[model samples]
Target: MKTATGCTVISNGTAVIGTGAAPIKDATIVIRDGKIAYAGPVAQAPEVEPDATVIDARGGTILPGLIEAHFHPTYFNVEALEDLDIKYPVEYVTLLAASNAKLALECGYTSARSGGSLFNIDVWLKKALECDLVPGPRLAASGREICGVGGLMDWNPDYRKIGMDGLVLLVNGPDEARAAVRKLVKDGVEWVKTYPTGDAASPDVNDHHTLCMTFEEMHAVVATAHNHGLKVTGHCRATEGIKNALRAGYDTLEHGTFVDDEALEMILERNTPVVPALYFELASIERGPEFGLSQRVIDGHQETLEGGAESARRILRAGGRLGMGGDYGFGWNPHGQYARELSFFVNYVGLTPLEVLTCATKTGAEILGREHELGTLEAGKLADVLIVDGDVIGNISLLEDRKRFIAVMQGGIIKAGELFRSQA
Candidate 1:
């Protein structure tokens, strides 16, 4: 909550820069009033203030603080579809959301864009974070996910007489979709999240390849959201759904799992950012059985994992923007483990460590539309930087280990890691 007023100097580290260039050895980063003034080789760094606070990186890797592009601050320990909304009342879920926000900040995520939240909780969560009432990432809230009546999120049976209103807004047609986007605009959401297709979670009903919202409804959502100066993203899995989203002008695509050649070409042509969110599928396949998930569900997740990884590889190879972060509040993939997505991409999706880092930092900010302000270590950007205990390029998994975090800075203020603890 504190605004950093004095100048600060971070030196003696290899800077990754988050610009896809080669890492700079013996780099120095200068901060002034919570903005980066310089970031480059020490030999070319400008002279610092005489009484500036100095932080030694200790031969660690300096890079931009990570951005969780497909966050869900409202979901916690979700084991089943019902667990997302029915397991906890809205009041309790709000508290849990606050806790998850703090955990994201401590885990080195300086910014996040909520993929979806319950009861528009992320809107209020963003306000609280701004007021310093709770610690959290810089959030772009999507109040609630927009889905069709029998979509992937509407898993509760009609006989149960329960509504999915807590987590999703179920619309019947294009008019209803437009109305829903208006409601989100009134609720102060920065992005509109919609479901263009079902998910692997609902195997029998609306599986991964099944379309949920029609193309007309999807078009209505994008048109309405864009009119209000808000971007739109979709939970797109099927090939047709991906094309529909692209045709409807969706700003981003989540879990674009079954993208085929046509969808891939469309995604590249539109320059749309895609979040594979493959880690969630990995977790479901590897650990779902322990949580009583049925064999069918596990197999569905396996299929989703393979399809998503392949699509992600193709997108990256075609030079499309691939963002990181998604579905981190499940029982298998809990909060505070957001960095696992980075490692998953590097290890399983065949991305180099540096490529994955750029995806998490630079492309992530671009997806959020804050690239000029939040991403990279370049001058004239927010001073959100991470100092890892070792060469993160050499050991990409080092970022997943909290013990290796020497400092996590947001707006030039030390928020977590060794430096914050020492100050405390």
Candidate 2:
């Protein structure tokens, strides 16, 4: 593609660790029309046109924009509330979602996937970001979670009613499950989310057992979603529910808290990616009381934290694909702390600094099926890049410091940085 007007060039920076091992120093990246035209050693760069913008890197490290494969945008502003009993209006929730989107971008995430949320708010947010009506990352969203009748949320008085904010769609049998998948598709959802298990934290519910849909029901959901070109993500922490979701062919498992040896092996065999929302668990424990969450939920959260590290270690040892995502919005976990999850993955799961970064960037893109479009810093890719002040390869903690981000560019636009002010 021809270089568009107001093209930008980032030069004299150390291209940080990409998906592959090793870093390229003294690299030059050419951004033409909001896409990377070239990325390599400075010596090999093409001659820059007089009108194109050139930015000095000051020896900083440049890397591809980070990707968070799982999160909840609706819960971004939970801190504003004082009590758990305060039921937020749907409009307020949508605004919170928009704020989270912007916060994610500010935190250096160029793209993210909302695991589940209400009213398809992410869909609208994605559009807003594309149109530049709002500042945010590109979002792939699951409209609403499909659950069994009287599933995680109790609605015994009227079983037909789904959860508030149009967030949950209740389906009873195989046929209903299939229809639910189609309904989300028609609603323009890019991914489908379902609960194969109930919420363990609720005091009223049984935490150990599986809250299952029939085998046929799960099968129909998977098949229907696949046929419609959407990936199915299942919420199942209990062993039985996790196994059932796997057998049903879910593309990814969210919050796999109780996966056993057999289930882990099967996950490895199937090459299914697991997103352990460890940060969310920790945050929940910290903020549960404020949410009026029963002691059972709080206790269950503590148990998840205690065991989550071991589970992550086992999954890594088994060679299963892993991605980083803080299920934002459940409680205290907010939108901007995407890097916090990496600390848990590194300290608890024993991932090296580079490995953890790779999981968050390259591996995360693969899970979202946007490897070609989003991950890595290479020729012919979107110019989603971040420049940090310190050497990220030597110390991963540098990534957590917001001040370290000297420049944030997404699609060649200088979203942050004084260097591009003259160009603008």
How well does each candidate superpose onto the true structure, as a TM-score?
A: 0.98, 0.88
Task: Put down candidate 1 lDDT per residue, 1-424, tens digits, no spaces.
Answer: 4558889999999999999999999999999999999999999988876999999999999999999999999998787768876788889999999999988988899999999999899999999988888888999999988999988888777776655468888899999999999999999999999998988788897988899999999999999999999999999998999999999999999999998999999999999999998999999888988998889888889999999999999999998989999799889988988999999999999999999999999999999899998879999999999999899998888988988898899899999999899999
State the TM-score for model 1. 0.98
Error of 2 at 116 (Å): 1.2
Best by TM-score: 1
How well does candidate 2 match the true structure in TM-score terms?
A: 0.88
Superposed Cα deviation of residue 6, candidate 1 (Å): 1.2
- Residue 345 in candidate 1, Cα distance off native in Å: 0.7
Output the worst ten-in-a-row residue range by lDDT, candidate 2.
77-86
Q: Write the per-residue lDDT of candidate 2 for residues 230-285, one digit (tens) a residue.
A: 99988777778889999999999887777788999889999988888787777777
Runs in model 1 lying further than 4 Å from the true structure? 159-164
Candidate 2 C-alpha RMSD relative to the actual structure? 3.3
Q: Deviation in angstroms for 397 in model 2?
A: 3.0
